[model samples]
Target chain A: MQFQPADVVARASFRLPAADSAEAAVRTCRPLQDELRPLAVEARAAGPDEPGEGFTVEFLLKLPAPQSDDVEGVLRTAAAPLLARLGLDAGKLDVDVEDRDAIVWAGDEALSKGGTACGAYVVHLRIGRDPDEPHELLPEGSLTDEEARALTETLNSLFEQRPVEEH
Target chain B: MSTPAWWDELMSVSDALAAADRAEVAYWRGGAEDGREDSHEDDVPPVTLRLAALGREFASHAHELTAEQQHRFLGVLEDVLRTGSEADGTAVATGFFESLLNAWNGGFDLQAAWAGVGAESQACCLDLNQFWGIESPEWMLPRVA
Candidate 1:
């Protein structure tokens, strides 16, 4: 199944050390535009709010399946130089990747059974955060049965169920 | 006009959806004559006022909504956003309603989302803080004051 361009959305927020100003945050993040320029469909950095706690930078990329495995690594690697430039600690960064293709697969499954998929086809993954949010179905069509099963297995693996406690 | 008892019954997904629809219609009616000299004494649209009331009410009773109700409400909200985007002219009331929907979604700190809603509303020349009776600008943004 062919995926659309810009189907992958990667968002990263960096919380600067307490004393950082909005100007400093922007200056630190400005290098990312040059680093991600080649891979991005669209990219932007939202300036830090007045308190200067943090700021966010987002990228929409048209990555093919072969490059999927290295997404997080690429994100971290791209962010590293910027962090080093700003003398910011890596621990303060939060990264999230949304796989629109997986949502498309889920949506197709729903639509095949005559169910409607609402809104946009997007799957939000907060990188290191717990997976508790309900997944939404993407709008339908495409993907082989084998591919669908594999993707389903991958998604299912992300959420581990805890054993129930007996009273 | 007195608030309907059905408004309190909005814990049901179906009722919530119906309330949203009714609120949208009422908002449009009020917004239609917004700048006219003959506009009603209550300059704020009934939908905007009702949604703000609903936001407060829903926040207090949010836990009462079933998981299914929360999921369905999110879906309904996405539809509302889609409809708002497709309209020839986006309405400030729509942004206000979106803020209420985000508040109802809960779980995350909604300051940033609220800020975006406020910015969108003001871009359309509506002062959400004044209309919603909000005092702090920080409440609209993600920053904690």
Candidate 2:
């Protein structure tokens, strides 16, 4: 089976630190923007309840997943360059397959305890989503490379969290 | 006291969104515990899709909202996050607004969803974001207890 162009697309979104300016956020994401492809980059000022949220950025990158099973592999490839640019300390990265039927991240890491089932393809890479305010991101020494890799594995498994489907 | 019509609409929007999440929680719990299958009847779209549509709807109408509407919106969320309705000294689940705010600031990328929707609607979302922020400086993250 082959995936449609839509299925190959995913969006990554996160907020920069509250200290950064909106211009910096846009400039930072500029390298990922491509006019010829499905890639889209956007940055906008945030509305913090207090002040100093700075900005948020989102990128819709189209992966080369011509085959249905190529989804996970493409996602992994996409993540490396993105993380290298956005860096791990950026914030919580939420990536969701544009396809309607993909399994998603409902903020639950595990299944409901029976066997396993999947929903849509949405994953929240917990960089700094825990802070009560935008001013406090990831805290200090909060995230590790190993944990990010593990979370990426969990997101890769479309059917179950058993393991990253060896595609 | 009677609530304004917009308040009711906002309530419905938030309630339906909450109900969707609650249903998802139930589906996960129900399907796993007893091995029951997913209901074929509720063939709704993904929660984010539904949320995006509803949020866009809110944004379009947001500019028309009055101060009373804003007060009610802020008051209800504040009451939940601040004092909260308690039963037997146990606080209720107030994740609806927190989750909604997270949509604005957290992982959901709501503003991205509104891309090309229009400048006014996007402006309204930002206004709501600022409103929530100023009204509750502790608005971004979900509150515990």
Candidate 3:
């Protein structure tokens, strides 16, 4: 059977020295999401109580199965120019497609597990993905050469953490 | 003791904007883990400095807030950050005030959802980065705790 455009989920994690550094990273990443907005039916921003630090961002990109190979390929291509501009490393890049689900939920559900205000405000797809015959576009794996190089550079500054300030 | 009317009003507006921003971003990100304060610094618009100031004012008065008052304070905080600025700021502000018209009409425990701050009341704080199928910030795992 031919693949349809909808079964792709991109979940990525980032580590910075401190929460503030993470915030900077997210800001840097926003343009990436904005660029994908037209291509993907949905896009969003999610993280825990703190804005920066160690955060995980997840977004669903809808792509045709014929272009399934292009899913990761596109990300790899996208990562290069962007990461290069930001000066981050591609080798240390942490990106992949971990699951195949019909509907992709924005934000991590784990935060709410402890009865905390951890609800990062999960953003639903601006457009929902089809459940039946969902097309799983990208699978978790290594990024292309360019992606690797760019990610390694981005990581150099993006993940460098700082001390959390006392409230 | 009664909190100042102006303080209450400021709290209400600040909370509304913050919650709205938070909800909208989360919705867009597709339910990714969020809680770190650092993540928001970039996402928030420059105008948000106004709201942040209000948040600071609210925090300063934290000592004066009752348990219920504090809960209400935190409850709206989530909303302001999640959905406030993305939507029409003026409209959101108006809705917040309108909701407060009968703020106590049918509700008293709006605080239930936001009872406290810190880890117990917050989402997971992120300190690491992963992308391009590789994880970085080698110090992240050890620092998380």
Candidate 4:
């Protein structure tokens, strides 16, 4: 089966290792950002929240696949390179796929076979906090803005730390 | 006895045929062996052996397979890759064999590609060289990922 386009995004928060602010974390993640780009995939970064106080990132991925099911495994595979490049280890990666079959073609055989006839195939993905995992401070009711920020900060710090001794 | 060109082609074809048989066997074995239809027979040793044979044949006749067969082979590879990603490894592998059979029957130069591969690990390289149309198995190429 041919794969349609795919979109993937992951968000998380962690404190900076030496730095006290989210800016440094943002900077660190910046260089590694392009690594997340899938072939024919677009990527954008949004907010550490409150002008620049907390670290919260959102990634968007688009892939070329016929079904939503086509996006997941590719997204997962893409994550490995990002982790290495960012020097950031993920506490949680919330991956989501959206089949953006907004338009349909009138004459395409694929459309007859159930694929959208027109417009680009799209898959939207989001990965962030996991409510199931217990947190020390946050009372879970979905991550509040502040809680999400805190998590982002923690992730930043964890990722920013130096690698251990390699013999 | 040193391998002859026809012998190689026949071997490759036989392998493709065997892979088809294994895939059928795997489908049938799925329910009873795993209890949940969890097994993917495509990746099984038998199927891989079959894909290897086709790869050897493709290698042998690289020039012949380079024709329109290249595109068709790429299509099959994509299917194999996608299925392998979603389903069990064996099932995905088997899917490639099934696809290879389709390409072979369709008149693609599967034997040439299989034959071109060097004797050493030519069989093992079928899955690996799937894209450039070299050592790749006729079952897998042009993968989406």
Candidate No. with top TM-score: 3
User: What fraction of the genuine interface contacts, i.e. the true contacts, does candidate 3 reproduce?
Assistant: 0.00
Show where candidate 1 strays beyond 4 Å.
Answer: A1-9, A16-27, A38-52, A64-134, A142-167, B1-120, B123-145
The digit string of per-residue lDDT tens for model 2 on B23-96 reads 54344234542334653323322222223343433344444545455445444434433443221001111122
lDDT of 4 by residue, A42-140 (tens): 111112321222222222333222333544455555454444343333223334344211211122342232222211111223322211122336443
lDDT of 4 at B29: 43
iRMSD values, candidates in order: 18.0, 16.6, 15.5, 21.2
- Candidate 3 per-residue lDDT, tens place, A1-167, comes to 12234333232223222223222333444654565432211112233553333433333334323234444454444444433333344443333433223121223333233111321222211112422334444334778988878777988878888889999
DockQ class, candidate 4: incorrect
For all predicted structures, in order, the TM-scores are: 0.24, 0.26, 0.28, 0.22
- Cα displacement (Å) at residue A8, model 3: 2.5
Give the DockQ (2 decimals) of all models: 0.03, 0.03, 0.02, 0.01
Fnat of each prediction, in sequence = 0.00, 0.00, 0.00, 0.00
Model 4 residue A119 lDDT score: 15
What is the per-residue lDDT of model 1 for residues B1-145, given as tens digits with 9 covering 90 to 100?
Answer: 1222333344356564455445543453445423446544322222333444454444445456555665454444344434442221122133334345445446534443333333334333224334334453444443435
Model 1 residue A32 distance off true place after TM-score fit, in angstroms: 1.0
- The model with the greater TM-score, 1 or 3, is 3
State the lDDT of candidate 2 residue by residue for A80-150, as single tens digits.
44444433321333343332222222233321211112111222221112111123323345568887787
Q: How many residue pairs clash in each candidate?
A: 1, 10, 109, 66
Off by over 4 Å in 2: A1-7, A18-24, A32-38, A45-52, A66-74, A77-167, B1-145
